[model samples]
Target: MATTFPQHPSTRLLRDLTHSLPMALLRTREAVVQRFRTVLSRHGLTEQQWRILRALDGRDGLEVSLLAEQCRILLPSMTGILKRMESRGLVRRDANQADGRSTLVRLTEASQTLLEQIKPEVVEVYKEIERILGKRKLEQLYALLEELEAGLLEGQS
Candidate 1:
């Protein structure tokens, strides 16, 4: 026996209403992430590596634990990123000045130079995204996303 999908017009609309929002959001996120990854890759960076670099750029030195938190990455994964970055001379990891047990990661001069080179392109991409969405819609999107993120964090806790 063969199964039939719903043929009723109302059923189609209901299905779309129920599925389109999440599907569209996920597709949009995937597209944007792909673009971001492409940009980072050109600079010899992974998404996680970029996150670590960006964090350290804003604050030159940070504990690995704190960097992991800021990057929203697991400690093990962050350790891997740091190791690779360190090997490439993009970052330096040393015992925390005040705490021998904790490691502090800092960007190297090479990493800072790379960031300076890429900063303009990064800003241009951001501007393009905002232009595509329009300022008002972008603000609304940010608000909606912040609420969603907060709800997710609350649920996790």
Candidate 2:
């Protein structure tokens, strides 16, 4: 025979963990990112660094603050990441002409070449996702995610 503790009444009030929206989204993100992680790792880039590169791509440059916001990275962490990237010849920083107080960051020629080299693999990962999910479902997923984001943002505002 084994003794068992009684369940708390409050435990029944909470949603099941398996059905949690945030956890589901996080699980999905991790699953998807795992595929891209391999490609990023092969190119010696972290997810944050890849996000920074992608944000800067096709743009002349962006203010450090703007880049941090776009990349969803904190200002302090962005500073250190930029310093490492600059030292690695992946990025360059210059004084902002429009706003003398801010610094602007841009990808280096080497990073541009790296981006070109990595794009095919990145695209392939997207294609694989489309293949797995079916294009129609993938499009629906994108639309739903966009709608969800917009709705949440509107609620906040």
**Cα lDDT for residue 140, model 1?**
99
Pick the TM-score winner.
Answer: 2
For all candidates, the clash counts are 0, 0
- What value does the lDDT take at residue 141 in candidate 1? 94
Q: Tell me the lDDT of model 1 at 154.
A: 100
Candidate 1 C-alpha lDDT tens digits along 100-122: 99999999999999989888878
Q: What ranges in model 1 sit over 4 Å off?
A: 1-22, 155-157
TM-score, candidate number 2: 0.93
Error of 1 at 45 (Å): 1.2
* Superposed Cα deviation of residue 33, candidate 2 (Å): 0.6
* Local lDDT at 116 for model 1: 91
Write down the lDDT of every candidate, Cα atoms only.
0.88, 0.96
